[model samples]
Target chain A: MATHEEITGSLQAFGEGYQKNKKLKIMNKDWDRVILIKAADVDSQHTLILKNGELTVTEGTPAGDPDLVVTADSETLADLFYGDITPTEPYMNGTLVIKGSEDDIVRLDFISLMIWGE
Target chain B: MKRVVSVSLGSSGRDHKVQVELLGEQFEIERLGMDGDFDRALAKLQELDGQVDAIGLGGIDVYVYAGNKKYAFKDGLKLMETVKKTPVVDGSGLKNTLERETVNYLLRETNYLNKDTRVLMVSAVDRFGMAQAFTTAGCDVTFGDLIFAAGIPYPIKTLEELEEMAGKLLPEMTKLPFHMLYPTGKKQESRDEEKAKKYAQYYRDADVIAGDFHFIKRYLPDNLNGQIIITNTTTAADVEFLRQSGASRLVTTTPVFEGRSFGTNVMEGVLVALLGKPWEEVTPEDYMDLIERLEFKPRIIDMAS
Candidate 1:
């Protein structure tokens, strides 16, 4: 399990990383969506709002429906946002589960790739 | 006379039709690219059902093997399920046998490959036999399945590691849409320079680059420095691109017809047509036997002056 502050800090850092990545901004200019990240182990949830080529992270559930939902252990979620591990690693191992359309999932993966080069 | 049609999700620009005599049989071979439209591909398969002698599913793999475990792709399986009468194949049947022989042929007939060669296989799960052949030949092989397919930087160095990774990843990954796993439609026609530059070291460090042409071309660096590329489904334009990229040689496992090598799916469809049996009943030994009788030789090009 992870502390609430740690999870929120990691999510904020992930948003900051995306904000600073020019290539990711350009690539995702037209991709606007609300993504819900649920830490299964910690029973915590966070919302990632992407609109107009910008990303913002907020703790807790979103006010409306989310276009995508990513479910993973608290540690895995923290590590993913902290850039310690890639989503591919956990996703491949069945530790991370994402529910969304294929296009949105690929775009999210590409965002991670752009933010943390291969 | 028999006819075989390959309904593909690739770019329409690469569609081709040819008439060839094989093993004393006259056959009309055609490849129709659907530009990544799944509905269109399904409709095409329905239209061709019971009409063609055999159908080949292109641009998507119905199954990929790792070790002895085989995983099925959801989209590929859906495309296959549309047909009722004609046999359909996604090329996995021939990739295992034909690609292994191609490696052995190169070892026996050409100087391009040797024990000292450093090989980079872009995606091994799709062609496990070729990967095993390189390892069996005692060549240093780096399987780039994770690196190329998932944008992960990890390079699997042995068949065991690849199999282990496959066991963990492939089950869930196969359920995703085919395009998420592969490049299709017009996406095949372009390369991402940023990705190419980021992963160029893997290409520059290898003596031989092998695997799917699209995966190889997706991140192909501008300069290969005389590296040899071993793949199939190369059009004349792909050959010219390789030559300009400084590749020394090109080896296609399938024989080239009308200036391009047909995909393993097309070749496998041809084999199925000649075998005159259901695809499930046909075995690897059958494919090898026909290959030996036909004296099928790989199409090798010397790109370096």
Candidate 2:
């Protein structure tokens, strides 16, 4: 299991990665959504808010409902946000689960690709 | 007379019917595109259940391969299960043997391919044999499964990596809707300019681009700089499109009939009808034998040369 500090650090790294990706910003200009990341193996959740082509990550869930929910083990979730592994890897193995539209899933995957590349 | 029908979830604009004599046996082969409607395709499969000698599931693959393991697509299997009486195929049987022969043919009879050739296979899971052939022939090959299917920019360089990736991903990925993974219906007829521009470098760098025509054309760059294309299921219009894109040559693994080269599914349907056996009973050697007996040759066209 990943500790709270590790998860927080990973989310911070993901935020920095997204902020630096101009291509992802342009691509997600019209895409606005709140994504809740739930650590299935730990008592933690992170909220990713995308609005006006910008992203901000918070430690807790949004006040309202999230458009998408990503569930994975604490380590896997941390690894994904930290770019240690691609979302495709975990998603393909059934270790990571996302509840969202296909478009949203693909867009989120694109976020990882643009940030870290394949 | 044997009758074979290919029901596709592709554009109806590409539907065609042809009569051909194969090994002293006459056969009527027809293709019906459902324009990407799964229910319509399922209904068509049900309608032609026992009516046709063999049925080909086009625009979708029932199975994709990695190494020796084959993974079934849930949607493809669902579409296939709708037909109870007809022996159904997704052209994978012929794809393995015929596409391998095509690569060998190119190496033997033409100067277009050699050990030093660089190949960009747009997607390999659906055409693993062709992917393996390019690698076996000592050519530098890039498998673009991630690039084309998932909109990722990674170019897989070796078959070992491809097999490893497929083993890890295909099990779960196959459960997703078919349309999300591939182009179907009207999606096959359109191209995304933004994607084309983004992936243009892969096209420009390759000496040869090979795979399904739809995938090849989906993100095709405006200028190819004399790259050769190896694919199948192309109409005359597709040939013109390749020419306009500045492709130097075009090669279709399947033989042309009625001015178009039908997909492997249709051709496999013909073969299945000829053999008069269950689809599961057919083998690669059987396909190769029929191919030799029919003298099936790859259609090569000099688009710009």
Candidate 3:
């Protein structure tokens, strides 16, 4: 079992990596939006704001017009950034939930694509 | 670390050996392609049986799924019967599991498939898992199985439309020897570049292009800007080709390792070895579990700026 802070740190690192990735940045040019992610059981939350081809992560779920709202477990969310999980089967099987525009979902997964190269 | 080897009927040029790290473990993956020589493929399978950690038959499927029933191919079944000491599975096992996950990954998590998305599958039968996933995801699905695989040269709009043809088509086709129906192994290595160009219209019309990599590569035009390809199997060189040709994104259902995404059977053999299960004991669900645990996403090339 991972602590909420540990998962949050992983998310922060993911944002930093996504910001520094040139190939992923090229894919994310049309993907500027704010994304809210909440872990289902731990009450850990983070906001990923994407603009000007850069991604910044803020602690807690700040109230704003987010482009996407992603909800999953602390493990799943953390594992996702760690490059060991794909959200597709989880999303299809009802383990992961997303409330956002279709394009935003694509942007979020594109980050995973960059990390795992898949 | 685990060792997995495949006996492939495809050409020798495609034979490869590589190491990959997955599921918190290391794997040495080796494949021997016989260049469309069934005698050699079986002989190699015979020699390697019980020697390697796991065995796989590549470049062809063992079974076809329609509804809930599965139809097994004769050559594949015979080969499976020969391997007594080691577990062996045709590529179908991983195709049934990974291809579906890969397509759904793109459809639900990516903007590639929505109501308005136009999808063209070069040979849906070659990757039926992907074809069904796209339809289930509610995209307007097109099946080129008859056109590409059966040589009918015309695309059908729905699974229902293709199902109508499968009953008459597969029974007779499956009865014949495997290679007679379609080029397998090394036979696939060569292409009729001009003939391949005829299907350019299908490639041009779709926003999302999905299918078996061989079929996709056969018909894909040189220009594919903004097009999203969802398929299984790809080489690193293949990726460079798509990138240079202006493809926006390339999504290979199998995960990339050592500069190439592998055949479905090879991935399945890895799972069987990891789970310590006999070839027959491992169900498709088990295959799905290994993929889920590994968190292996489809290899993607997102050169779309």
Candidate 4:
């Protein structure tokens, strides 16, 4: 029910909130990873970049090898931002799937938990 | 309009209504919290049994699931047998389905707590769904159910310790009345400052504190400057309380309405009423479908406290 731009904008806003947070937790400064979220329904892409302990959301690839790639429908991605559905069920059922190394998958998922706090 | 009511023995003497409109059909959700008075709450349930469209059993869960196992409470079963009316669900069924989704949502969507996160779970036995999710996420989870819930000190180091304690505690927990577990009000906590002060260290030591709001609130330090709290069932005043205590970020597992996040039983009642299906006939898939369509996402409040 949401557009790719809307999802991108929402993540950006969430990143801004994290930055403003004085006592919030962030991925350690030493760790940085670029994640590509592919919305197969709309055939659009948004990148979530975490570098130097700060997070940013931008449209399309940001000139870096993404450590993780998540593919799912637009509604599923929208619901993820809205804090409802988890990628596990979709990933398990093959409605939504992810491509990444074991460490990236685990670490990125942990980061996702931190961002949304579901 | 469909009418749904919740009966609870551990409501701590609170009662109210929550309204949710699904597909343009209005639903009235009423919660009757009898504090420690189970008899009164049971009486209320009997009065509304067949009259109401659905009934929600609050406070104590009917079944607690852990890994591939489930343990049902004897007292909860008795209440169900007596009701014998319209669909009566404890919300545990939906909780089992939704809480896992919630954990996975956090795991794959947000960057909240990591494996190194020190989580102090007040009563993992009561909400096994959360317990399993936290452990699966690889957090350094500590179970404080014995100390926090039962007012007995039992330091839990591993998930094994938690399982052992849950096996023993969950049974006896439902037998006793609510007052034995929790004091009546915040002021009552002053009666045991020594105990409260001791718990402040646990609150201070943990990076990411996770548990029920009541348990966390019972032991919160005067300040929580950089703490991230993961809990449910909170009121607006509780939010102010956390803000005053310096909670850096707060997220309730359930949606906050009016000034509080409601009990799962209330949410389940809403779902049952909306589905308009017999409780026994509904499945996890049905709940998931209704949840996604409803998009009843948990609330994330912006705190200034």
Give me the candidate number with maximum DockQ: 2
Q: Which of 2 and 3 is ahead in lDDT?
A: 2
User: Quick one: RMSD of model 2?
Assistant: 6.1
Off by over 4 Å in 1: A1-44, A47-118
> DockQ of each model against the real complex?
0.11, 0.14, 0.01, 0.01
Q: What would the per-residue lDDT of candidate 2 be over residues A1-118, giving only the tens digit for each residue?
A: 9977788899999999999877567657667899999999789988999997899989888999999999999999889889888887688678999999775787687677567653
True contacts kept of 4: 0.00
lDDT of 1 at A117: 37
lDDT of 3 by residue, A1-118 (tens): 5568878878877877786776456545545788888888887888988776677888887676777888888888888766566665566566788897543454455455545542
DockQ of 2: 0.14
Once fitted onto the true fold, the runs of candidate 4 whose alpha carbons sit more than 4 angstroms away are A1-118, B11-13, B168-174, B177-179, B182-192
| Model 3, CA-based lDDT | 0.73
Pairs of residues at least 3 apart in sequence or in different chains that clash in candidate 1: none
> What would the C-alpha RMSD of candidate 1 be, to one decimal place?
8.0
lDDT of 1 by residue, B19-50 (tens): 99999999999999999999999999999999
lDDT of 4 at B122: 71
- Between 3 and 4, whose lDDT is larger? 3
Query: A1-118, model 1: which lDDT tens digit per residue?
Result: 7776788999988888899976457546666899999988776899999987889999899999999999998988888888787676588668999999765786676676556533
lDDT of 3 by residue, B71-168 (tens): 67777777777788988877777787788887777766766778757888877665677778888888877777755664434578878756655553
**Residue lDDT tens for model 4, B1-305:** 88888787654545678777777888887777666565776687888888988888876657765446566766567666668767888888777667767767777777776887787777676667777888889988877775675544445757775665455344344443344454433322243455567677777777777766666776776777577787776767677777778887777776666676877877788888888888888998998998898876655555663
TM-score of each: 0.79, 0.81, 0.68, 0.65
Candidate 2 vs candidate 4: the DockQ winner is 2
lDDT of 1 at B115: 92
Q: What is the lDDT of residue B163 in candidate 1?
A: 85
